[model samples]
Target: MFCRDSESFALFLFSTDPRLIQTATQSGVGGVVVDWESIGKAERQVGFDTQINHDTVEDLARVRAATRARVLCRLNAFGPTTQAEIEAAIDNGADELLLPMVRSANEVETVLAWVNGRCDLGILIETEAAVERSGELARLPISRVYVGLHDLAIERKTANPFQAIADGTVERLRAAFEVPFGFAGLTLPDRGFPIPCRLLMAEMARLRCDFTFLRRSFHRDTFNLDLRYAIARIRRAMREAFARSTAELEVEHRRLLEAIATADGYFRARCEMNRTDAVQAASQ
Candidate 1:
């Protein structure tokens, strides 16, 4: 149901405040995503960069009322509570439900049957098992799929998850689904630490990504700026990105890999430093 447009990409925002979400939607944000997928995230990502949102079904209803744009509710992983979550989301006005941390097709199939076409169903491909079973999952009648880098980084045990993009993992997952699909997040095109947002957009353009999430940094990085102008700038750059020649795309790809490698090396070094410090402190 989301990201069906091939000619362009949609930007989904994750927030609970109806006023904030309404402002974004009016300023060209494509969709509102209220995330509730925090079931074991704290335990899963103990020391990692993680965001565990506590948006509720009531918040979903409130945001649903605030915008005419599509509203997506990300439920916890497919489990015992999934049916109730699905029913509550739909009853509260979720246009679509996003299932996270999927590992099997049966999980998706069960959700599908329970949903009974009441609303569109989406899945997150963020686990090693999910990647392996992607072809099987893709063949199902899923409304859409998003390749989540956060959970995936924890699953792959990699210091830098963006490496997935450079190493062809994202490409592999991207190839599996013919449905509306997306991965990664975006801030303003000129801004991202370590990996510039421009490089990410070029990669998305090269991959023909249908949509992407608007990172929290998008506003903070470009705050006080006109929202419409910022969205327009990114879209214009995206248009320019789509018209690039193969050689241009290749050059951009290499730059992205270099950026990822630099970030990864730094992150691993920092982790090692922290471990050394912990050992020294313990001995003291």
Candidate 2:
């Protein structure tokens, strides 16, 4: 699943736990995705500092206890924080661990090794190289692969949202993985801004993508979006986005075809002129 920054997820948990279970229950979010690596720095070399008081771990556990929502952790990829993050996620009973910036089969192996056969794992394919190796990724014990559209688009030089989808990346991913993957089409730099939830749900349905991370920009009355509105907004945005993307793809295809035709015509004219020169030389 697509896990955005962890700080926001932490804030969401802190604000809603304990006395707000009823409110949180009504919010309809799947769960908060935390970056365990970013949650709190360890004061000691071996573990976190006890002197500095922050009930982050306790709070998270309480939130978990209080809400029906899942707690997913996004760990630092192969960084110093990975171990600590994994430990914290396990201790806090996080439902999933989102491994960020995976580059190779080996990286996936490394994460699996660290998990030591515990906890669910998800991955973010955010690089061109990662896309190239997506097949290997899908074969791993990952729960899901989230389409990191912004990074993928940047790497492919397809800045347009419509072009990005039609660039054959997402399609290729679906074809390759053949499993329901998550998508991040609602974030900044992506045209699916504000996450029309209805579109997100629809696109997810169309692509058979398992999940689409909610666009952080979709405002909520409380710390998070109401699940209903979030889902609706995402679904709506995806449908509109798909339509816009289709139109854009058609235009681009037409433009490219025209350019190719013009090039062919130019080449034929040049060849004809050359033939005329040959005829004149033969007459002489």
Which number leads on TM-score? 1
Candidate 2 segments whose C-alpha is farther than 4 A from its true place: 1-28, 36-59, 156-163, 185-201, 220-284
Q: Write the per-residue lDDT of candidate 2 for residues 114-173, one digit (tens) a residue.
A: 888788888888777788898788788777677766545445543332333545577678
How well is each residue in 1-284 modelled by candidate 1, as lDDT tens digits? 23322345888999888777777788777898999888887778654555789998889989888889999999999888899999999999999999999999999999999999999999999999999999899889998889998789878887676878978999888877888888889888889877899999888877878888988788687778877788778777777877887689889989999999889876666546755665687699
How many residue pairs clash in each candidate at the backbone level? 0, 21
Scored by lDDT, model 1 comes in at: 0.84
RMSD of each: 3.2, 16.6
| Predicted structure with the largest lDDT when compared to the true one | 1
Where does model 1 exceed 4 Å of error? 1-7, 269-284
Query: TM-score for every candidate vs. truth?
Result: 0.91, 0.60
The models' CA-based lDDT, in order, is 0.84, 0.54
Q: How does candidate 1 fare on TM-score?
A: 0.91
